[model samples]
Target: QPQNVIEKIVQRYAVNLPTPSHKVAQGDFVSIQPEHVMTHDNTAAVMSKFQSIGAARFNNPQQAVFTLDHDVQNKSEKNLTKYRSIAAFAQSHGVDFYPAGRGIGHQILIEEGYAFPYVMTVASDSHSNMYGGIGALGTPIVRTDAAAIWATGRTWWQIPPVANVKLLNTLPEGVTGKDIIVALCGLFNNDEVLNTAIEFTGKEGIAALSVDERLTIANMTTEWGALAGVFPVDEVTIKWLRDRAVYLARTQNRKHERINDERIQDLVRNPLLSDSDANYAKHLTLDLATLTPHVSGPNSVKHATPLTTLEQQRIKINKAYLLSCVNSRASDLRAAANVLKGRKVADGVEFYIAAASSEVQKDVEKSGDWDTLLRAGARPLPAGCGPCIGLGVGLLQDGEVGISATNRNSKGRMGAPTAQAYLSSPAVVAASAVSGYICGPQSLHPTNPISKTFAAFHAHPQSPIITYTDNATQTPPAKSAPADVIPGFDGTLRGEILFCDADNLNTDGIYPGKYTYQDDMSPERMAQVAMENYDPGFTKVAKKVRVNDILISGFNFGTGSSREQAATALLYAGFRAVLAGSFSETFKRNAINNGLIVLEAPQLVSDLRKAFKGGEEVLTRRTGWDATVDLVGGSVGVGERRYKVPPVGRAAQELIVEGGLENWVKNRIAA
Candidate 1:
């Protein structure tokens, strides 16, 4: 019974059940109590949900962390009041809290040692995958999932399938980890690793990548459609822990006993690695030496172009950014400074820079990288998620073409939907800013490009091979009270269909970023702006259709951001269910937690598109195509065509039937 790194870490945190075997494998729904649950500005929304669930005190206060970083630059009384309220809540609950400008929550978690090796951490952010860089098993959960953890200290999660990605050779000078991930996303755009966990191997190549580089690569795996991208805990990881411990002790004047060398050595002695015979759904080998500086957007992460091509295209840029949880560490700042050493930004271009955390900012300032960037005419923003989440200053204006070192460039995420954004490494971004267009650092500095080869293969999915123990008599944990009776699900839903044929319908398109931090938004207000970014006529279509009509979309619906409001907005807009070719895992969980029905039927979606004769409009208002979804029967009926769909598990059905996990947890607490 060989287990991969992800499986091994999951088993360590999995709650024991009364079964013949305690071992866990891929696709098994196991209850887990994670070491930490992080929420940033979204903490306010989670707090509301927690209170709604009748939770007076945290089940494990110390395990929770609240950070205010998303909208740190916002000084509006409303925003400040919300921040104050979050601080008050954290203090009252005895939970760790970081105020605005402290740093992005994800980076703060790493800086403070909350996300350690082999630890299971979940955050209310898609970028939580970044923690996997440090050998931790980190994943994203919806706001409801966060609230559930607060109420009960445990929640159910299905172990995703794993993929093995082996890196060979060392990276070229100009090509950073951001380029490596961007190249992967662009080259493997066909849902190759969608919804799968990834394990990076190849000891020599892993050793060559700095911790900052590893963090950047792992952070963008969210954009690459993977659930997690984990690196092995080798000497590189151990050294980082030791260095961090020393830095903490020297700067904060406090000893961090848990992160000392002895503990780190013990961890390395029992390093977590996939067994030799562990099964992987897919395998990819990358030659890092062959990698070139790449840019991945203009709107989509899947549209990757080598920097040479962009330089040839002479794509002019009006704005440039080097900030986000992904890049903006001290190393990234140094790279940017190296490119902008004695140059100035183009006359018409505006370049903005922000560090990942205040601690990182201090480090760069001490190293003179911060001064070099400022002297190069880069505007300094607060050490937070400035302009990355479409907040604060430096948002792209209409018709602006911008390049960024951030992880995502989805439409309307950083600014105007009509504006275009391209993604690149920090060096490339700085170079582009100086050149007044998109270009790599190589354009300014001479370097020879390396040529190399690699191999990859997709293995057939394998069934889990579990070894059972003879301990069937093990008792499960006792329930505090009897569970209240929840209404039964009929397994049938009927609704008219509203079709949106666009693929990659990101969360930003579903719910605009402007309203994301408005914690006091009512359902009516949410419905009014539902899909406004994607299609302005969406509300009109919703009004014309029946109240419980189903919303249908193309592939990868709800693909960007971990904002649960994306699902809730649709729910409040009267969509009884969402039928799509596929869904983002985070969005699926959010929909399920909010009791919104979600079904996947790719062929059926294509057929419906043909039946409606809908064009390429973002949203189509059709007259017919009524659908009846049968979850238990595992089929969907639209007109006379019957389409097969996977059956929903009982646990998920129970959550939907009970009007979400909040009600389920409430009933359990009451019982």
Candidate 2:
């Protein structure tokens, strides 16, 4: 545990004695303590299960933070009722809660000082990795495990193998972090970082970036299929925090406090640098000089194309959004605002700007960017996660195309299933808003680099109007250990194979976030729509199947978002196991925690794909293929031919046998 930042942090909070191998490498199971656990609107659904288990009260309510973000506006009476239930739960439980309009949970963590270096926090959102920019271990977990954290201050974690991404040189003007991450996705193709922890190194390259820029890189790490994205805490981080503190004091009209060099330094652990002799599973070098404005188009973040060539493709769009945790910081907003200044949006284009937080929103108003954007016909949305989860305005119509700053452009992700969405930097999105098509920032102004104007726009941005309140006491909560269960695979599992292709099937494709507001929802209700976007008739197939039915998919299966409901819905739909080439770290965890086993069967998956005529190209035309999964023998069967299935590991196997983490904990506590 000496060489890597992840191992060091894990060792500090780990409840079990560390194994010798865990010291240098990864893939070891350990239980660790989380400083805080964050949940959003999904808390209501999780609380239902927590209560069903007869847990009297949350063990440490102060460490639990809940926010109303996903369905902030409550489009229906059912949605409103769910919000009321969430509010009631927070009030009655004595936990900290942020109501609607409070901004995205990730933004709230930074502005409110909840995230810090060496801190181990977990959120239900996959973008929880966004906090890794500040050097915290903010990993994603399922809602069921989140509920377990409410009862016990600790949870189990598998120490992921580490990889290092070294930025070789500083990025030139006009090229931003968004471009760097998109390039990485295109290069690595999602599967490379599956279940791996990525530490971005190179002090010179990282130091050149602003805090917002660093955050943008970390935010998209989830899209790269990484377990977490970490940037070392340094002088730049210290300065950003101090400046933010000063801004908060000025806007809140309070005495200068809450942030200082000494206080910030105390939060970090000793030996901040990764050990010189540390081992890395993989090492990659990225030269920023080669980077340019890039955009990921139509259906996947991995399908990136350089913006210089986008015009030749003539990709006109109906909407452009400059928002989301990926690019909604003050610096990011200013860069976009500078592009929109004195320029009108194209006649048919709908431009939308949403500040990541109320603090950023206030900064936009103070800097006069709000008026500038309004004059350019950009609609200023509320400060929550507006339209990122397809919750608010800017949902695309059928066959419409939208270019957005938000991460993940999976099909049916933003609006109608047939709508096409693309991802890019806010500056590119702002310029595209004007051109009514995909274009780079250089297209906006022939004479100026976009970076040159960011400072001028950033000049007036500062201060939050809200007051900070500390609910958690200085004393750490006493640990409540979960029962040690190490169960093995017990029986034969057979099912029809549900074929899904690799490289970009996200959680949204599994269980769409847009239907989160539907009334009287249940596992069955969700099952009907499970994988509807990917395979239109999957629900019908699932309904006709018996228990232990299987789903076979290509690489990076379940690659986007961290909605536990994705696993829950599939389980309800009668899927007992998912055999795929690989899976996103969060999705794999969610599936296991819910008792739906996820087996890594690379060859079986490849053969499953080849069973069809055009292979992956014909994924949409998939009909059911039968496969018998023999977990007891560590292999799967298709027409009497057996192929090895990757071991589920002792910890994951234990959880699967116990019917998920919830059942394991429930039975242990009862015993």
Best by TM-score: 1
lDDT (10s digit) by residue, model 1, range 1-671:
67888988988887743343555666555568899999999999999989988989898998899999999999999999999999999999999999998999999998888889999999988899999999988999878889989988977676776778888878755467887899888877778778888898888888999899899999999998998999988888888898888888887788875566677777967878778877676777777766766789889999988776677789999999999999999999998998788789989999999999988998999999999999999999998997998998999999999999999999988999999999998888998999898987656543313111101101121111111111112422111111122258666778887788888999999999999999999999999999999999888878776766788899889987778899999888888789898888978888878888777777888786776674644465664777887766567887788886655545556677778788878987887
lDDT of 2 by residue, 477-543 (tens): 1111222335466556766676666556888888888875576787778888888777776766667
lDDT of 1 at 119: 91
Give lDDT: candidate 1, residue 424: 92
Candidate 2: list runs displaced more than 4 Å: 18-25, 247-262, 267-269, 445-581, 584-587, 594-659, 667-671
Candidate 1's displacement at residue 483, Å, is 20
lDDT of 1: 0.82
In model 1, the runs with Cα more than 4 Å from the true position are 16-20, 445-581, 594-659
